[model samples]
Target: MNYNIVMGTDNKTLNPLVQQIYQKIYPNIFKGSKDIVTELFLAVSYDINEPPVIDLSQSVQLKKEDFQSYYTSELSEEELFLDVQEEALILNMLSKATFQACFPNINLKLKLKDTSLLNINIKVSAKVNIQTSIEGKQNYLSATILTADLEIKDAEDYKKYIDELKKYILPLLIHVLNKDLLDKIKLPALTFKDVTVSLPIPVVEKSFVTAYSCIGARQPDTYTSLNWPAETVFAGIDSHAIETMAAIPFPLKKEKEFSWKIISGHVLAQVFNPRAFVIQADGSIEGKIDAELLAQLTLKKGFFKISFGPHGKATIKATFKPVVHNGRLLLTVKDLNIPKLDIDFGIAKWAEYLLKPLSFGLSLALNEIFLPLVSAILRQIEIPIMHFPTISFEIKGITFNIDIIEAKTSKLENQLLISGIPSVR
Candidate 1:
């Protein structure tokens, strides 16, 4: 019996499915990662029986009279018969089928492991066993079989040509097997989306003041005996007042549109007062006089209120300022009023009278006490506060705004530049 076979196998049935699998599997495999096909090839090898034999010295002859009769029209020339070999005919047909199946479009030779023939018409068979895994650790196996019949033309050509086929065919088989395994597994999909964020505006402001107080002074007397015996002796005492005020305006405002949770907040404030007095030999005071008052008299606190509407409208208002009068400086809410809310603090009755004046006065006193000490120490140590005698303030507030503009999905292609400090949670 004469036999010949061509075998082919692909796991994916549909063209679209094959393309999808190719797209998904190609990346992972190309990324230098381990793949099922690579693993399988490393695990097994193809099995072939005894090596095929070819003898070039043998006479090239038609195997049977029927062979000549069958090809009479094709081989009309009698001299051409000498070129024909019985073994070559069978080997060439088998080689062609295997090459076509494995390489598809490429032309290649086949390796024959066995050359013995039992009949004029040769029977050939090809088979492949592949094992691989798609989802889990366990590997699955698949097998294919191909059979065909071919007529031999030359026995010598078959012997020398078949060996060349073995070297190239094995790799092609592995490639086909690998592609099959990849088709069975599912791959992960990657996606990206655009997100919107708001930026916060920072506002900083500053102000300052100066004030004074009174002190008593005494003078010593001198006695002289002499002529008139006036026995002059003089002693006198008097009280006089001096005035000085240091006022600093420190204001801070920050506004942020909220979408996600607030991440971080920080606030800092500093106030400084520097004063000095020079006493002449005549016992007269001439320099800066520093006085202390209630803490509220010099300190001010501010608040921010934000309101959000269902329709996504937002309103933000801030109430804060500083007050300086007659060498006295204070920070009070009296300067702040929300007319729309009908909220008002009379000039004298506001929290300013309670906290602002006291804070201010305390601040002034602190400056009076610390400024001179600091200055004196600095003079001795050669160090300065650098930015002293200035008041600084900071406040942080956060509110959420849920009304986000519906962003178009396809617009995500544009790269987004998010410029802002994200809150720390």
Candidate 2:
């Protein structure tokens, strides 16, 4: 299974990345004049009047589909949205139109379709895409722009002015953006040779044009078996405790018509050596165990007598559901079961003692105590997965961090996968 280390980009990130690119090409940001085909010597120059906003007319509210829409410009999917209004355009409409129109402001939006290249300048790109990468030695993401466009939406009369502006402004914007974008997005991913970054159907917010790009990844080879850090589970489980226990014989007692035996021996409380935790492809956890049962017991027909064992060992296998409560990560044990109950002394020494009780009665002691015992050890000791940290990777010496939230486990082929929402930092 492929594990995706998602890297998200937003305005807070985009603005700065684009800024560096724009800065290098500046000093004069669209304060000039142009002669229109109508012999209109329009000398239009303006300064930033109001700062850019996502959209003052409304607050940006998005849905899950907003980030995965098929139609470009679906919602809040563009790479950047900069709606800027200069103080106002001082225009000289030369010739027959030798008059200055009192314009409120020149609304120049550097609105990227996939999008952005923002400034007070009236030039924008058409479509853009930010994607994950497993190819790089260090970085996690690679950003690319397909095309760009700028809409002088309110400046209908300024058509001639815009046409001339695009000649130089647009291409310059695209070049700078392409260079900077590649360098800024650096996210870390599991890049084992066997692992693959899936290029599934590209899903991202709306774009103005058609452009598709996607990325995914798989697990590192070493993940097949993982051991719990604590090294031990429950109490008194060590050495060949199993071999010695299995050797004990169940003592038999004679009775009228029915024979009986009272069993007493050693048993490991936990099902297995909890430290040897192996996560299965199906998400089940099987702990390693060297198991043997020791017993001396009395039993006849449908009834049996039994007590605790000290040398015996059992096996505990379970599935885990990773949960987060109040920001603290936890593995809630689920489907806890005992796969092998090979107790010695012949039968099972059981949890405590089951006198004349049915076999199901034996489940009462071990079943009840086993699950909680293992779970408590993990929580109390602060196991590693319990405090998942912000994942980070570097690119060209720059480091980027992604916080994993709402984390849960999933099946990825034969590997254990823990996927979560990537909250940007």
Candidate 3:
């Protein structure tokens, strides 16, 4: 009955996911800065795992100093998440650039003899400055590399190469970060894991209503007989309560009854039916009765009445239509048919007259039972979760209404898929 909203990165868990992204971007980084290797005419092979491990730890927290906007106080959590910090973004961008420039044209085999081949190692670190502006709902992110240092191993004059590449590669790196990467960056939505909610059983106590009359009453001559027998005739019953069930064509059983008096006899009719049903997308329910007749009734007056007429068996088929009340979907019994009705005894014929009413009552009761149950189940449920790519930080829950971002659902052979994109604010 309660909701919790949590937003933060699990840095330890995200390490592997982040590594995968680096692996994907590694080849492209080398390709973009390939000139760095071609200029020195040095052929060398490198592994992506080597040197300059990226630090994404800073992306988890938001600092007011990180945003260069005067409206920083006005930003909500969602906006802060969307507006990625400029320093962290720039540092990560420069890391990729430095990585590509330092390790280039890897996997090269050298075949020079006697001349000791100089082995050189390179490591890079940087200082970055950024400016952010918001003009008419458009956010602009740009950065300048204040200083970039390249540490070299086994080479005394490597500083010159470091200074040269700094001028060439830093500008290109910053340009791509602002124009390509950050330009497309968006705030992520929140998502939830599967949630289960318990539902209450849907049913009303014995509340069926019916009317009866004295049809087969034994007549006494004058005032001679004081105990006159009367076979209570149940003319009709309110099936509206049962009609409610036609919407959910599922099989359900309940203790049902109608109370009435016939002349001098008190008649109690107990109706019971057990049915199973399935619901289709178009709001139609199709189901068949498990036993003869939609239900059987026991009529009694101090043990003098009968328990279901003899040979009263029927193959009843039922259908239900769906309706939406408030914010929930509920079912109503639309139609009931007795394609096969078997009346074995003469007394059983009387029960057949009340079959339609009986069916309607059952349907109505079913509808009442399931309407709120279905609604509650849907309201308390949680949808499939979504997270930021690779970093594994969740962005938002799956939603249909299109706002700044929205998610769409697709069904595919026992699977549900939700995909979406965030729109600009």
- How many steric clashes between backbone atoms does each model show? 61, 35, 32
lDDT of 3 by residue, 1-425 (tens): 11111112222322433344345445544323322343443333322233223332222222343332223558765664454575566434333222111222122221113332423444554333333333333223233333444555644565544554445444444444334433332322221112211111111111111111111112111111111111110111012212322223333323333333311111111122324554444435455543322333354446455544322343456565533322122444566554333434323556555444454453344334333333333233321122222112211221222121233322222112222332211
Tens digit per residue, CA lDDT, model 2, 334-404 = 55554444333233445434443644544343334433444444334321232234455443344556555
Worst 10 residues of 2 by lDDT: 90-99
lDDT of 1 by residue, 244-266 (tens): 22111111222222221211122
Off by over 4 Å in 1: 1-104, 114-188, 193-425
Each model's lDDT: 0.23, 0.34, 0.31
Best by lDDT: 2
| Top candidate by TM-score | 2
Which model is ahead, 1 or 3, in terms of TM-score?
Answer: 3
What are the runs in model 2 whose C-alpha is more than 4 Å off? 1-125, 135-139, 153-157, 189-202, 205-321, 324-340, 345-425
Q: For candidate 3, which ten residues in a row score worst on lDDT?
A: 200-209
